[model samples]
Target: MQLNYSIEGGDFTNAGNASSQVKKILKKLNVDPKITRRVVVALYEAEVNVAAHAYRGEIIVDINTERIRVVLKDEGPGIESIENAMTEGFSTASAEVRQMGFGAGMGLPNINKNADELNIKSDVGVGTELEIITKLK
Candidate 1:
């Protein structure tokens, strides 16, 4: 099955909607609990990143018998240094964002930890694309 979600930038209240929908689908499909949890975590992180950093973006989810793939594409300020962005305690979120209980600098790191295969591509002034795949066995 394939699912697509449009993430509205700067909408903190709706940030996790995509992840929640994905979780429901996985559960309905009887995907393993562990795999579902990992997918949800990674997807939630990606969703938050798009809402917090991007001007606009969308998440594409592809699920098959063997694996689940999530692609988050955003047109925004674009990450200048993906290496630094992946660090556990690195963040560029504003004070207002931090006050909302996010921006603890754990988004990318947590996504990386939860995904079985992760890839990030970014252009300094253009945009960013994050691909995360988790295998189900």
Candidate 2:
């Protein structure tokens, strides 16, 4: 199955919408509880990253018997360094975002911990793209 979702940047009110939808779908599909939880965590991180940094974003989720893959593409100021950004407790969230107690810099690290396969690409001035995949088995 495949699903698509759009996200607006800085919209804290709806940050977890896509992740929640995907979680529901996974539950309905009867995916393994462990795998489902991992996917949801990674998806939520990616979704929040987009909302906290970019101007807009879109998520594409593809699921099959063997694995589930989610792609998040966003338009905003891209990451300057993936390595640094992946470090736990490192974040670039704005003051407003920081005040909300959201950006703890754990997004990418948590995603890496959960997703079996992860890939990220960004252009300094353009935007970013994230691919997270987890094995269903």
Candidate 3:
């Protein structure tokens, strides 16, 4: 199965909708509870990242018998340093975003922890794309 979601920048109120929907689908599919939890957490973090940093983006989710994959693509200011961006406490979110209780810099790390495979590619002046895969076990 495949699912796609558009994420609007700065839309904190709807940040978790995509993740919520994915969670519901996984439940209906009878996916393992632990796997569902991990998938939902990773999806939520990726969705929030787009809302907090990107101008706009879309998340594409694909589910197969053995694994679930999520791709987040954004047309926003790309990461200057992938190394730094992957760090737990590194973030470029604005003060206004921080005020909304996000941008605490935990998004990427949390995603990494929940995903069996995570990849991020970015160009400083271009954009960013993230691919995450979690195995069904």
TM-score of each: 0.98, 0.97, 0.96
The sequence of per-residue lDDT tens digits that candidate 1 reaches over residues 1-77 is 89999988899889899999999999999999899999999999888998899989989999999999999999998
Candidate 1, residue 113: lDDT: 98
Best by lDDT: 1
Highest TM-score: give the candidate number.
1
lDDT scores in order: 0.93, 0.92, 0.91
Off by over 4 Å in 2: none
- TM-score-better candidate, 1 vs 2: 1
Task: Compose the digit string of candidate 2's lDDT tens values, residues 100-137.
Answer: 98789998999999999999999988999999999987
TM-score of model 3 relative to the true fold? 0.96
Instruction: List clash counts for every candidate, in order.
Output: 0, 0, 0
RMSD from true fold, candidate 1:
0.7
Worst 10 residues of 1 by lDDT: 7-16
Candidate 3, lDDT over the whole model: 0.91
